[model samples]
Target: MSAEKTPGISAIDTTNFARQIVLDFEFAPVPKQRQRRGLRNEIIEVGAVKLDYHGNVMGEFSQFVQTEYTEGVAYPVRELTGISAVDTAMAGPLYVVIKRLSDWIGRYSAQVVCWSGADRRQLLTECQAKHIDPAAFPTDWADLQTFYTSIMDVGSHGCVSLSDAATWFGIEFDESTGHAHSALADARVTAKLLKQVMDGDYRVSPRAQEIRQRWGGWASEPRRAFPRSAPS
Candidate 1:
């Protein structure tokens, strides 16, 4: 088979494949300085696709969490994500959305997957600020971008956007899934990439473990379901 047609990794490798739930997060945009300082990029949306070991999507989740920022939705964020103050006017608060997310996660024994370390860090930051139970979050995570780069012989630090990765790997991204910033659509696309990358064997990168440690790894905690938040 041509290199383009060959699956680089084995689909059945338990180390690489688990019941995996690919995740993507879109946060309320803050100024570049604030974002770099980890000052205020609140997660406005959460999206995920639950996949079986064989890469079949089993389920999906999406939520638009309301923000508490007083200035209202920033225009840049709205322009980029297509999420406006009006869009999230009736959405649940972050805690409520997180509660629902935890419930959804309980249905599967799956590892959380995302494009990079940013989403995991954002989750940790948000959870820590709210005093939300970390146990509610997925413990295991794998960065698909790092994995993709590694397998494709690109340097570990290569800059590959989601669209670029999909194009490189021959994965089809559905444009009708809405804009790139929509979390659920991004999650579905990431899951598709995961399926492609997992078709061959690759070792887990140190970045995965680093992300796990930053979030305090995994711990079991009692589940608490919040009554969905009311419109602000």
Candidate 2:
């Protein structure tokens, strides 16, 4: 991690800002749309991506979590995420995945971005549900979702979806990058979309500045605890 103090409450070079940040998440299996969403939420794939300034893709971290079903409940994640029973037959347990995620984060620095609190919430809540410590999400991260909202001007609508953001920038949206419900894939896409939306040659400076300015007064951290896994 860089030793620089965060340029809090002011817009420093945003590219520099993003470089200092990291994105966290887990992809809950998205089965067939609204119908299968609940079933797929059982065990999600966890992942994260790091980005450096100048819009460089740095590295990625992730692991698959094998949920331990309740007493009489058998997890049918195969149909939910399209991962067959054979695929998860050999996968390790939930604790192992959480440990891997913790190792990936190492010691946290500030600047973790979530489009909304969704990914952030998933990581923390799921960890808790599994009896894992959730501090892996540090106190230094930034909430781009909230920050984006305050400055976006809210034109009868709002900032685009991550996928929409890609489309808005004329970048091709690859569903394959999504990993169905693999957390790492989701993180990579989010990181890629953020880079595409904020970087040069493709991004508009005024819009980028709008995002940065929206960050003002927004905190670099939150103290609330994540709710445990919701009904799936």
Candidate 3:
């Protein structure tokens, strides 16, 4: 791919097309040992991927940010994501990542489905800390949790972890993709899950069209069971 052409937008790439656009996020422990009150605050890294409206993975973006507030030590997150300060910093800075993110998002035309609903809060937190405007991104983003909670009201799984419902639908998970802990990996998986949900194979609330819009590739057919969104 030439640097002159951006992914997803450039249909001529031929190799990549038909992918939907979504953002993924992952976090790891700090380095040695600082300290934070909540597990959410110690984000050591962030990542993302871009897909066109048709479900083809166009390209990717990632960042391994350095920080002063969070503790850099062994925590449950490390075991889950395998993120370390050494590897995380290689991705780049939040400003660089966030700026790229904004450029990638373009217009709100699509929705955002996230593994965790708290992603908005965390992302905004990063923006605030950097004195950047969080509102610059779309205010219309939604979380997959909203869809999962309404569908599987059983108090979450034993692992209490997120999975790409799309990957789960597949006969076998793609292990070669490696562990699904990186922010971009998680984001991509969630985007895939959104695709699965819209596949009509799963039962979601009729009003889940919003979620579908976030994940549905342009080629994906709309489900008949979806209820129209209420007028704002």
Candidate 4:
């Protein structure tokens, strides 16, 4: 790890971050017919791809999580994620999946990576609601969007989506991941992008200041113990 450190956060070690476990989540919203909902966006899938220090894939984790939604899967969610109610019907509960994921991730001394902050926020919210200890999550993380914008010297508007990022890296989007919403597929793609970024000496460009400002400010170091509860 580099000895260099950013303002309030620990050293912005791209190399170290790339070696960490990259994760993603696919959540299903409660059916619209329900006037009352348990969780706003209930997690239906959890996926992760852990990388070694050289950025090679070391292992992976993927699972369909059962939600408490009695309405079954929403039509739109099924259409978007291709995850039907029946798929999650016999899957393990959210708490159980979370526990298994925690054990898998706890074995490493690496950070977590994702294309955006949405997955982290969702994990925090779900864990909080289920009374699962959020502390098991790795404190360090890298938001690929922010890093990509910086490395490419692109301004905020130039930020690329996951599929776009794959194209930029010259990596084919694997169709086997079960469409774009497949958590494991998405995580795999994110891992590839991480490798590209780590292989270079890219740093967040000064333009990133503007984007960070829009989000309030640069995320606190080690990030916050948890992000604000995910949007309703």
Per-residue error (Å), model 3, residue 79: 3.2
* RMSD (Å) of each candidate, 1 decimal: 14.1, 11.8, 11.5, 9.7
Predicted candidate 4 versus true structure: per-residue lDDT over 84-144, tens digit per residue: 8887998999888877887887655777777777776777666776677767667676576
Q: Which candidate order results from sorting by lDDT in descending order?
A: 4, 1, 3, 2
Which regions in candidate 4 have their CA more than 4 angstroms from the true location?
1-19, 31-39, 153-158, 175-178, 201-232
Candidate 3 lDDT (Cα, 0 to 1):
0.50
Models 1 onward score TM values of: 0.72, 0.57, 0.62, 0.73
Question: Which scores greater on lDDT, model 1 or model 4?
Answer: 4
Instruction: Encode model 2's per-residue lDDT on 87-203: one tens digit a residue.
Output: 444556766765675566556343565566555455554556556675554544554444333433344445445543433334443575654334555566666655643542333
List, residue by residue over 131-194, the lDDT tens digit for candidate 1: 6777766676666665554444333335457865565444445674556778998888888776
TM-score of 4: 0.73
Best by lDDT: 4
List per-prediction Cα lDDT, in the order shown: 0.64, 0.47, 0.50, 0.66
TM-score for candidate 2, residues paired by index: 0.57
Q: What is the Å distance of residue 158 in model 3 from its true position?
A: 10
RMSD of 3: 11.5
Q: How far is candidate 2 from the true structure (C-alpha RMSD, Å)?
A: 11.8
